[model samples]
Target: MARQLDLVDFIVGLPMPVAASPQANPLDLLPRRPKAWERMVAHVPAEDVRISISTTWTRVVVEQLREDGCGDQLRANGSIVSHDVPPGLIWPEPCRLILMTATSAARIHKRWCLEEAPGTGLTNTFRFARQQHADRAAVSQQLRLLGEGQS
Candidate 1:
């Protein structure tokens, strides 16, 4: 004689659902915007760096560097400075300003990581670095041409 099936037995007898297939196109998986508090950084040769905080729509300066509980802190004068840039905020001079999320200073504890842009954002570390390098090279070339003309 067949035995009555218990709840656990019935559940165990059910077929498992098939896992969804991965997307065929990579672009379809891209995020709409960067996650909040994503870290971004830029290394500039200038004595002071200007940052435009998108959230507050204000500009701040990083005149010096400090090590603190928040890892590497950029300071203006004596106070620690931090900036926040929301998604879709087009910095007037994106080439000159380095934008980051506020928590970039408070949370992430790596000095090198603090100097990198968020993996996904309006601008990324690789692109920003390349642009800065290109800009410097262009200026150098222009200067050389002017010197040659004068000679």
Candidate 2:
């Protein structure tokens, strides 16, 4: 006993908010960017070298690099991550890349990155991956496809 429709709205009527994980002590979106930068240095070990960075959007690069990261110690203490790569792992480069994206290039420039720390050697794989509304676009596309299929 259900009615069927032939069209769907890609936009959800009520959108959920994009909030920081409270378990990680959620922060305002803007502040989270800088915090991510510091954590990138700490969480990723020195032995792991950079293979390729998607784009030059510094903050997004930093944010994605924190994929392997946990918690927000960096934000609270203002320190970079300091983890050690295991002995056997060959520092997964080439395959390991960070994808950073934002609405505009100009916005990405404001994240206030600490630049390349002089002593940290340029070998470290810390870079950005840019996307054009990739996340939202992907979700919308998926929803649309689902709707079309249902019809």
**Candidates' TM-scores?**
0.20, 0.21
Q: Candidate 2, which segments miss by more than 4 Å at Cα?
A: 1-75, 87-91, 94-137, 140-151
Give per-residue CA lDDT, model 1, range 1-151, as digits (tens). 9999999999999999999764233112111222221122233222122222234323343322221222223333334444454433442223333333333321211111122334323332211222221233433343344334433
TM-score of 2: 0.21
> In model 1, where do residues sit more than 4 Å from their true spots?
1-60, 63-73, 91-137, 141-151
The numbered model that scores best in TM-score is: 2
Please give me the total number of clashing residue pairs in predicted model 1.
0
Query: How well is each residue in 12-73 modelled by candidate 2, as lDDT tens digits?
Result: 54577998643211111122345356444444542231222223433422322323333222
For model 1 the TM-score comes to 0.20
- For candidate 2, the 10 contiguous residues with the lowest summed lDDT are 22-31
Residue 47, candidate 1: C-alpha displacement in angstroms? 20
